[model samples]
Target: MIAEGVKAPAFSLPDASGRMISLSDCIGQKVLVIFYPGDDTPVCTAQLCDYRNNVLEFTRRGIAVLGISGDSVESHRLFAEKHELPFTLLSDSDKRVAKAFDALGFLGMSQRAYVLVDETGVVLLAYSDFLPVTYQPMKDLLARIDAAS
Candidate 1:
């Protein structure tokens, strides 16, 4: 996983709507970028569902989440609609964005993790691992945001 306090490279990955969303689009706001191995998988589902369940908290803290994977936009559309996810899911079909973030093409897919970036694109917190199925890091980030707010 990439270390904290480093600059997160900018990206313009396509969303389910085929719209390009870049890291700069989230300027002046904190962004939570969660990278998962794949969509419609067991652990990935739990990871996304947990974030989906905590969308309110994320919003109340003035943060936004973007889930990225190698899946196509159509796949992400189905998953997001089916699960009612509150955040945008970015499609990195070519794995370019994931590779730029050093979160993809490992183990034949993107690895599961989260990167919390400040308005300046500096990573405040980063987590990389597929075994953990909890949202502790997300919670921790919320706590920091709450304390700062």
Candidate 2:
């Protein structure tokens, strides 16, 4: 995992709509980068849906949530639309971003991970859950972000 207090690696990936979103674009705000194994899968779906449901909490705190996976933009579009995900669903088709964040697992699978980057792109928190079923809660994440600030 990337270490806190270190500058995050720069990245640019496609979103569900195929628009390019770069880490630089969120430079002035806190961003929660969520890395998951795949789209529409059981645990991944649940994890994203939970975030979707509480997205307002994140937005209220001026935080942006971005979900990344190896899935294609088409798959990301379908999944986000089906689940009504309010946040951006980024497509890291090559798994480059996942590898950069140390969120890549065996066989090139994306692991469940979360990286919190502050306004200046310094990592505030970096966590990876090897157990696919486990996910960090929004409340806890918010608390950590608040405390980090």
How do the residues 1-149 of candidate 1 rate in per-residue lDDT, one tens digit apiece?
67778899888988988999999999999998888877788778877887777788888767889999999999999999988887999998888877777776436587777788888889887767646454345576567555544
Lowest summed lDDT window (length 10), candidate 1: 129-138
Top candidate by lDDT: 2
RMSD of each candidate? 2.5, 1.2
lDDT for every model?
0.80, 0.90
Clashing pairs in 1: none
lDDT of 2: 0.90
Cα displacement (angstroms), candidate 2, residue 132, comes to: 1.1
TM-score of each: 0.86, 0.95
lDDT of 2 at 86: 92
* Model 1 accuracy (lDDT, Cα): 0.80
In terms of lDDT, the poorest run of 10 residues in model 2 is 136-145
Q: Which stretches of candidate 2 lie over 4 Å from their true place?
A: none
- Candidate 2 C-alpha RMSD relative to the actual structure: 1.2
Instruction: Give stretches of model 1 more than 4 Å off.
Output: 130-149
